[model samples]
Target: MAGSSATGLATLLPGAAEAAQKGVLTGFDLARRQGFPMLRHGPFGLIANPTSVDATGVHIADILHETAGVPLAAMFGPEHGFRGSAQAGKSEARSRDARTGLPVFDIYAKSGDALTAIFRAAGIGCVVFDIQDVGVRFYTYISTLFDSLVACARLGYEMIVLDRPNPITGLDCAGPVMQPGYESFIGRAAIPIRHGMTVGELARLFNAAFVPALAGRPARLRVVGMQGWSRDMWYDRTGLIWVPPSPNMPSLETAIVYPGTCLFEGTTLSVGRGTTMPFAYLGGPEVDGAAWVAALRRRALPGCVFRETYFTPGFSRHAGETIMGLELIVTDRQAFAPIPTALTMLSDALRLAGKPFWSDGGRTFDLLAGDGDTRAMLERGVAPERIVAGWQPALDRFRARRSGYLLYS
Candidate 1:
């Protein structure tokens, strides 16, 4: 996966990102070796979900237990639980690991004091976080990672992030930074909608900001960077397997369209959650499938084609009833940015249909995009290009700012 110089790096990637992953050492794979810099710590605790496995399907937890003589103090689970057995917003009930007898701590909803008790009981020397991030700001994995890091910093525990590929690559940044008042669990730090960096890179961003935010108590953070990982390379290139980070996000296709398709969730439409093809299809009772697709194409939005489709989701909103919507077919990733494309269709929906479309409000868009300005500009009769332009100044500044943390060449 690790290629040569920036020329070769850009050659491998599909876009402007001009670098490749290191060939010798991968972020997670490095831990498998005996005498790596990060492995010397004693009695380490793994804060990983199910996806924390090696290339050959070896679970990281099992690898460390077998290889290093490190005692497993306790396991920490993120939103979907340790094994990722539950769906979104759900986690496993506290249980002992049958094989290792390690106590599992739930950190998704228990970020503050309750979570702190678990860490204290575990008495771990370091926390290893190895989760694949999709490079979107609102995704909860980063939040879970953040809370864990914050806790580690507060108590002076070590944080070792085993880096993984950012499935959305890690170069092109889109949308505006989250404003002050809008900082929720979904949008805590000010970053674009599609932030192009790996979990480790995001940790770097956090550590730098924490140098100030922590008020002199910065996190003892160390990242074991990925080998053969280029910021521009997608999952298919790595020769490593792809694991579903959540129940709804089944495939890379689902992930690619997610940052945009997720916007539908905030609306009355079903973003294909209950069915097998979640985030790939969208529909609601009132949506005009053909009309919406046709009207959306009239603008000739780049890198995307809308296929008029219909479906009945097994669960979630608008379930058990067939509804109509457009299935986005992305022709070009470089030319086709999901955030801008989603906002355009939203604007067109508001323009073509007045109260019915507008009445539901842009709440879904607001939550999905993590900002009101983009959606607001569209509501106030702004064109998609202009709406995108309005946010570019901040977006550009962020792009330049984020360049400081680029891991790959």
Candidate 2:
């Protein structure tokens, strides 16, 4: 309502670039095409979710089970359950997948010795990880990968990663690095918030940087990379079907803003969890929706626009309460910086809403932000630019460390 109030949001978005839907085959697809050669070493367990599928929508566990020689020893599910029926911080109960008839074990928030026990109980010599990640540190799937890597390394299990695209293009990395002592299920290893690496690349990074500390060694790792996918390619460009990795993550647009808006979850505000546009909408009952929109709009943040809106969440945060906020309209994917954008909105909301902008004891925000610096910085009336600038040193160091693990250019 401030910056370009006279113009519609569509006017701020970038023009159509190229409609190149180049056929991109994910690691699972390639592995399936090649007759699941990696699993030939066999009787392997799979750590997967509903997101682990091919272009035709066939689940990985089902494919392996039907394969002639590849033994689908067991199945493991991460957060949101193996079938993806659960919600945030919750997972599906241990039950048999009705379709594949395979027993699904819960590995949601497990790690180290606990995960090792799961590995042992599975009675498999190898473990395969295939889950779609939205290219952020707090996404938990990567943490699942890291914990599984630690367990595999210690247990001497052959680990294979069926690499997937980082729905958000892998070309850019942003946000603050997680500091020491803030480790939790949300932010486990020390990495930047919006880490631009696929599961395969992250596996390499985890194995090289962290597994040694946790397991005294790195697991025997093999990553099956995606064919025809480059660092610059986003999900829309990859020609892969969009599957909601979790209930709230409905589309590629959700993944785009997630690394930034997800920080709102640390605050008392609802990050559109119960609404249809989760991560794309942000508001609280106390938030002055028009003021928040106008403040954000005045900043003229690149690649996005703020439009005033309202919604009643079915659950989470201000459940059953009609709350007002702004719906994010991302216009230019290449130019959009989600973490910085979200921080700007957050600082504005905190300034406008005052005491109402609190969270679940602030520990969740600290963990999500990697440390308490961001929250403290915002509370101290620091500008968003300065707060973002503070992250560059740590972000640069993380980028350097992660470069060695990158699989594609």
Could you estimate the TM-score for every candidate?
0.89, 0.93
The digit string of per-residue lDDT tens for model 1 on 1-409 reads: 2222211011112222322442324576755553444656677788888788887777777776666556667788888898888877788887887766778877776665666677877878678788877778888889877777777777777788888888877767887677766766676678877888888777777766643364245567777666667667777677778888888888888788888767766666678877778887876765677888898878788888888887788777877988777788888876878878877777665665535553257665675577777666776888878877877888888878777666676
Clashing residue pairs for model 1: 19-409, 21-228, 21-229, 21-230, 22-228, 25-227, 26-227, 27-226, 170-196, 266-364
Give the alpha carbon lDDT tens digit for every residue of 1-409 in model 2. 1021111111111111222343777788767766777789767889998888888788878878888899887889899999888888999877888877877889999997888998898889999999999999999898889899889889888888888888898888798899999999888888988888888888877787788888887788878777777788889888888899999999999999999999998888888887899988889866799998998888999999999998887778988888888899999988999999999998889889857476867888889999989999998999999999999998888888887777676
- Report the C-alpha displacement of residue 316, candidate 1, in angstroms: 2.0
Model 2 segments beyond 4 Å from truth?
1-22
lDDT of 1 at 252: 83
lDDT: worst 10-residue window of model 1: 5-14
* C-alpha-based local distance difference test score of model 1: 0.72
Candidate 2 similarity to native, TM-score: 0.93
